[model samples]
Target: MAVPGMMRAVEIKAPGGPEMLVETTVPVPVPGQGEVLIEVAAAGVNRPDVLQRQGRYPPPAGASPLPGLEVAGTIAAVGPGVDPGAVGRRVCSLVAGGGYAEYALADHAQCMPLPPGLAMEEAAALPETLMTVWHNLFERAYVASGDHVLIHGGTSGIGTMAISLCRLFGITSIVTCGSDGKCRAALDWGAGHAINYRDEDFVEAVKRITGGAGVDAVLDMVGGDYLPRNLQCLAEDGRHVSIAVLGGAKAEILIPQIMTRRLTLTGSTLRPRTSAFKALLVDEIMRTAWLFVAEGTLRPAMDRIFPLAQAADAHSRMEAGEHVGKIVLKVR
Candidate 1:
């Protein structure tokens, strides 16, 4: 297959709102050693992409400056050290950047083969949310079957994936959403309990739902004051994992409470990590979590698909806080 010299992509024109995302034609990137060129069919719109568009979360050093972080497509070309046979393979990849484009470059190790039954849009949604949920809920928090967890933003892509994964693994999940409608949606998505944060206190709700025992852990995205409240929702020897700080960065927590209860608090960002580490994580996923995905038992809760040129509208929908699940860009 011949690769094009130029391609259309969405670029952040200025550090501002969703309107800043503009489509432009630029020279298509060539794959470097250990990388592959992807003819993007679809790309997942995530909170990190929105942050990058706003100039809050910059891409890692030497990564593409474009906003998107995940993409699904066919491998158009392979670089040195990668098998030439990979050129025509279909995959969904966790890219560091450059996903909101007609063509994107991804590490060979980061690419996961797409199952025949999966749609490109659904495959695009898997890499980021699936890996994040698996690493945080199971690996970092050490949640297991029979464990109860409190998850924030239950209707978002990450939230829905967490809900489904927990349900599949026999872990009970209590999720918090902004409206009663979204709360109901979360419950229907297999969340054991859903609290409308706008109407009810999630900390109190978690306690009530768990019969005053508190949850085994909390998968929190809202930081700041929610940190202390999340701690309050934890049972003894519980874990709290923070993924995002959509609320505020700074927080005040009682040190004595952590000491007395032997609680654990930890978090991670996946973008800046080395490719070798990501490769190992991918290997682990292939052995465990990827089984369910391959079996067609786990599928992303898709919200809507926007054309690649309408990337700004996609971001606007995500920021509006009305979407129930994953929003994707149909680049093909």
Candidate 2:
């Protein structure tokens, strides 16, 4: 395969709105040590990308300033210490940055083989959400089969993946979404129950669904006022894992409830974590979840796709909160 000297990428020209994302030709990135250059076929649009474009979240030191977090494509080149055979292999990767491009660099360890029968766009949708949900729900919360978990944003990429994973693992999931249609989507995706947050209080709904025992864990993206209610919806010794603060960041928690209920509150960000840490997760996912993916039991719920040049439109759709699942950029 011929590698181009220059490639198109979406650059954040300034901190502002979706209009800030501009497609322009830039030098294709060269893979560094332990890295591989990917000819990006598709890229997933995530909330963090929106934050980065708004200047609220900057890429970590030594990372690409481009906003995308995950991409799927063929390896175009391999850097020093990486096997030359990696070139030409199809993969989906969790990139620190630089994914919104015709070509991008990814750490070799973060790349996973694309599951059989999945399109590039479907594979592109997996990396960021899959890793985040695995790290938070299974790794931190120690969620197990048969445990009842409550998920917020039930139709978003992370929420959809969480529901599918729970179904694969035999866990019961209850989810909250903004609309009744979204709730039905969640249930169809394997959530045991769905609450329309617009029409019902999630905490009350969780209590009702769980027969007053409450859920064993709660996966929250809405922070602010949701914190106390999330804690309230947890059963004794339950865990609450937050991955975003979409509503707001600050919250007043009832310390007494946490102590009395033996609850655990924890969270983590994926991009800043060390490559070695993410590699471990990649290995685990390949071993465990990849089987489900290969068997078609676990798949990405795709909402829409836009051409690479229409990256700003993709971001606008994500910002509108109208998407039911992952939004992807069709790079090729």
Off by over 4 Å in 2: none
TM-score of each: 0.99, 0.99
Query: lDDT of each model, Cα atoms only?
Result: 0.94, 0.94
Candidate with maximal lDDT: 1
Q: Model 2 misses residue 202 by how many Å?
A: 1.2
Give residue 278's error in model 1 in angstroms.
1.1
How many backbone overlaps does candidate 1 show? 0
Model 1 per-residue lDDT at 161: 99
Cα lDDT of model 2 by residue, 209-327, tens digit: 88999999999999999999899999999999999999999999989898988999999898899999999999999988988888887889999999999999999999999998899
Worst 10 contiguous positions by lDDT, candidate 2: 290-299
Clashing pairs in 1: none
In candidate 1, stretches whose alpha carbon ends up further than 4 angstroms from where it belongs are none
Compared with the true structure, model 2 gives a TM-score of 0.99
